[model samples]
Target: MLEKYASFCYDQIGSYILDSLDYFEDIRPHLSKANIQVSLPEYVSAMVLSSMFVSITTLTVLGSILMIGSGIAGLIYGMILSLISGTLTLVGFYIYPSIIIKSRASKIRDTLPFATMYLSTLAGTGTSLPKLFKVLSEVDEYGEVAKEAERISRDIETFNMDTNEALKNAAERTPSEDFKNLMWGMNHTLTSGGSLRSFLRERSDTLMNDYRRRVEEFSETLSLLVEMYITVVIVGSIIFTSMSLVMTTFSPNMSTGFIVRLQVLSIFIGLPMISGMFIVLVGGLAPGGIR
Candidate 1:
């Protein structure tokens, strides 16, 4: 449905949209890296159309509700909110490709060590390059790396691209720097008549070592984050709430309601926010492939 809408939007006014944009050219490479199937004009048009739809919906719903309760002032506030929502939606759409690229890169990095090990094993058996990739592509255990292998295989089989040409294209578009380097290395090794098996085996060892180091680093970081969460969120909140309660008992000038509100804020709002932040921190620090 969205694809159809995007296509229609592009067909109607794509040239005008493309002409008005300065950054769409810059975004083209990101689309390729992110593996987004849509053309640049289609994506931009979808973004515009989606943002417009959301803004209009927000305005109609919220503005009606507000106008019923607060008249013209409510309508004005609703309009402002709709505009903000529309702008944020547009910005989110614009940056979505970069987000996908980053995620794909992370997934590729996570799977690369194991994938390369498998590649090295296949190369040791004297399997042809095309057959090696085709086999890897069929294996779902490699995650994003498998998808990448599938693309390479497709290029060779379907697009009629030679190994070097396909590898060059894959290296250019791959989101992970490590994967890009690996592809380039493979291309060079093959072209120079070097031992592909030896190169892959060496690369596999290096990647495994790096992966181990990352996991170790994440273990240390996780311990620190655990300690911080305990001290700042749990123990600190208990102390703060207790102290506030005792203070309200002694100080008649301090409103009991205000003290209660503070306790509520600390226990309900602050605790959750701090805990959520710690969770996010731990997730970010944890190595991608440990599981």
Candidate 2:
């Protein structure tokens, strides 16, 4: 498979090209947040080398085939074409990791409210930091929250890090602002000898209230949308149909059969489109769920 081959290529030959790139420092932090298993330098190097190889090969073949009888201008055109294609590929390669990070962040954000509530509940029991994280990691219902907790546990146990250090590292690497803030709060509470239970309880309550407010706002918006849909799609569609029928009746050139059939087509296609737009709008604006 291409994936296996790409992995092999990165492992075997990618590091060799890393010294040539100057942006390794800037890219290192993103690699952590993106959950990419590869080193930043190696990834960039592999991408650069692969893109170069592809560009060179494309230029050679296309130039030879298309510019056989042409002069330097033809060769230059081929190079330009190949360079553009290769540059697009390289850009996509770099952007793919950021996309992954965004998706992960979205999932984390959605599940954060419930996870905080769970933490607040556990904190009230006077649980130790490691045990609290272990319980969180073990719970399968929390989705990304559980996965992130597992990573935190692994850092503490495998890396032999203290609780505060582990939390700080997690905060640094997590793509979710909500999760980062939670970890920072926990870290600060531990360091300040403050009450973790009260902090988590208050934070969880805030998230719950914010989530409820968003849902209430969405309900109000949905009511307005329903009225709009009736006015614009339903009644408007009926009025248009009536007008078309009237036109067909009055005009000798217009066909009733054609107008009715067109109305039928609009009913099927246009009605669904109007409904789908509302669905998309609600989905885009809905508060992320704690799932």
Best-performing candidate as measured by lDDT: 1
- lDDT for 280 (candidate 1): 80
Clashing pairs in 1: none
- TM-score for each candidate, following the candidate numbering: 0.86, 0.77
lDDT of 2 by residue, 46-125 (tens): 67767877899889988777687787877988898799878987887778778878888877776788898999899899
Considering only N, C-alpha and C atoms within 3 Å, which residue pairs clash in candidate 2?
none
Regions of model 2 farther than 4 Å from truth = 1-6, 9-16, 45-86, 254-261
- Any idea what lDDT model 2 has? 0.83
lDDT (0 to 1) per candidate: 0.90, 0.83
